[model samples]
Structure formats: C-alpha cells, structure tokens
Target: MHATTPPPSTWWSRNWKWCVPVLAALLLALFAAFVFGILMLVFGAMKSSEPYRHAMKQAQTDPAVTAALGAPIQAGWLVQGNFSSNGPDGEANLSIPLDGPKADGTLFVVAKKHAGEWRYETLAVNVDGGERIVLEDDAAMPLP
Candidate 1:
C-alpha cells in the first residue's frame, strides 16, 4: 500500500498572525494622517482669510503692541475662531496667539463683512502680564 501525502497548509493559516497586526497598524496610521490633513486644511484656510490678515497687520503695526511685545511680532499656529461667509456678508470671531522677543499675547477680533468690506467690531491684543491694547481703524500709527 502507498502512503498518503499530507495536504498543504493554506497561506492564511500560515501568515494571519503577522498579517493581522500589520494591517491594523497600517490602518491606524492612515486614519491618523487623514485627521492631521483635515486640521491643516482648516487652519490654512483661516490663516489666509481677510480678517486674519487684517488683524495680524493691525497687531504688528500698533505702537502699544510693539512696545509691549517687541518688534518682529509673529502669529502662532493654533488660532481658535469661527468664520463664515456668504457672498458679501460674513462674520468672524477669532482668538489668535502671538509671540515676539519681549512677550507673548493673544489677539481677539470680532468682525463682520458687508458690501464686500470687512468691518471690525473689536480688535485688541492682551499682552501677557500686561494690559490690553485695542486697535482702531483710525488709530494705527504710520510705520517708520
């Protein structure tokens, strides 16, 4: 009588232990990357908006802000706010962090867009351990 040959083991039965964890790790990494991409997109949009640009400009140029925070002021990355627009009308309420050679601060802006023009309701900077400096449209000192 001839001896019977054993059936070959399936690929799944041989590789599943390693494959499962590897696949799970890959999926986790992909999901994390997707979330990070979304956050960057949102932050980039806000940073590029007109209100953000205007507020930053005002903060950087104001004499009081410079005196408190020093020159070469820079905006921080993690800005918190709500911004919405439809055609010629929109609203923006933003809290932006700032840093410079002398100190750190937060810039707050409340604005609305009408007739395609942004009108700021409130624009101010609160220097760390110092007083708040309100920026007015007519109050910006001419840059030297």
Candidate 2:
C-alpha cells in the first residue's frame, strides 16, 4: 500500500482574515512613527540659534534701529534667547545687545512661525540713554 502525506498549510490559508488586519495596523503604526520623527527633526532645527541669527541680521538692516542707536552693529553684541511652539504656531524671544560705539541698548526680538519659517512680528529696542524704539506689526504683537 502507498503512503499518503498531507501538504503543509500556508500562512494565508490558515489565518488570512486576522493576519491581514494585524499586519495593516502594524504598518500604519510604523508610518505614524516615521512621520512623527520627521516633524520632531524639523522642530528641533527651528529651535536652534539659526533663527536668532537671522533676526539679528534683520535688526542690523532696520533703519529705525540704526537711527535710534546711531551706531553700527558690532561682533561683541550678543544674541541670546529661547523658542517655543504649539502646533503650527511658534514664538522666539531674542535679547540682542547693542554694543556699538555710539549707543548701548538691547534689541528685543519677537518672532512668529508661519508656513514653517520664522518671521519678525516685533522688534523693540531699549536704548540705555534714550527712549524705546518699537518696530511692530499693524495690530498688537501677540505674546509668546
């Protein structure tokens, strides 16, 4: 008599319904994680000193600031500050010292993030021996 052996069952043949859904869920979770990681990287880069430096550069070119300070921006003028974000909106506060020959003051920079880039909302300067100079938006500047 000849011996008959049963064929091994395939994975899909055994548990196709449950396995398909489980695999799809796992793939979806992985995709979400990948997207989240990318977002975190972007946000982290934005939080760096790059934006602060840009603000400082813009302040250097501002006519109002130059007229009030009456001095060219020097290297010794430090740029320092912090950044915070909530969803699509974000804020940065930069304390830029005016270490120039004619004046000494602090440029307070308030920036907001729109469309993935920071834009100056307000540039307020407090001169040590003069009045405050404020360059702001048409409406009231929002607090960070």
Candidate 3:
C-alpha cells in the first residue's frame, strides 16, 4: 500500500495558461479604461473653458452683439471640435434669449488658440428675418 505522493503534480496543473490570458485581459481592460477616462477629461476641458465663458459674458455686454441679438437676457454655450493639438481652432454655439425686437437664434463663435489660450476670432449671428451680423477680429488673421 505505498501511495508514492501522486507524482508531485506538474506546474501546468496550477492552470497558468488560463491565468496568464486572464491577467493579460484584465490589464488590457484597465489600460483601456484609463485611456478613456483621460480622453474624457481632456475633451471636457477643451469643450468649454472658463476664459471662453468669461469672454462670452463680456461679449454679451458689447453693443455690437446686443445690437444684433438685442440685450441678452439669458444665454447658453456649447464648445465644438476636437482640440487635440496646440493652437487648434475651436467653435462654440451660443443660444441667447434677447430682450425684445429681435427674434432669438443661434450665434456661431469662432475662437483661436494662442500661447495655450483661447481668444475670440469671429462672431456671427443669424436671426429669423434673414439678417446676419458678423463680427471679426480684424487685427488677427487666421493662418492658411
């Protein structure tokens, strides 16, 4: 009745092949999740910036913008485009409610990137009466 310890059971019996793929998959999934989270944060920041918002606030007070869209009673902003590179041009869609006289519509704002900051380049507003007002930064020209 000598039971010989069952031949010491080889290392493969520990299921390392399955474990390796499982661990690799887990690591890959974690890497993907981390990359995704980082991208979301970056895009979120680029989509809207405090500087842009403050600029919009200031623009609302401008007589030109108010003259085109009437006194801005309320407003909302939406930043568009992928800002993955330095000096990437961005656009923001502005929805503003006017005081009166002019029917409210969308305002398309084009902004530029300089020294890692955003600056207003052009602003355009199209109203219901086929009227459009465009404000541009004549001092600065967009690079071709």
Task: Indicate the TM-score of model 3.
Answer: 0.41
Pairs in steric clash, model 3: none
Q: Ten residues in a row with the worst lDDT in model 3? A: 91-100
Ranking by TM-score: 1, 2, 3
- lDDT value, residue 63 of candidate 1: 93
Note each model's CA RMSD in angstroms: 3.5, 12.9, 8.9
Q: What ranges in model 1 sit over 4 Å off?
A: 1-5, 139-144
> What lDDT does the true structure give each of the candidates?
0.93, 0.70, 0.57
Best by TM-score: 1
TM-score, prediction 1 = 0.89
Q: Which lDDT tens digits does candidate 2 get at residues 36-59?
A: 898767545543554566655655
lDDT of 1: 0.93
By lDDT, the candidates rank as 1, 2, 3
lDDT tens per residue, model 1, 15-76: 99999999999999999999999999999989999999999999999999999999989999
User: Candidate 2 at 33: error in angstroms?
Assistant: 37
Estimate the lDDT of model 3.
0.57
Top candidate (lDDT): 1
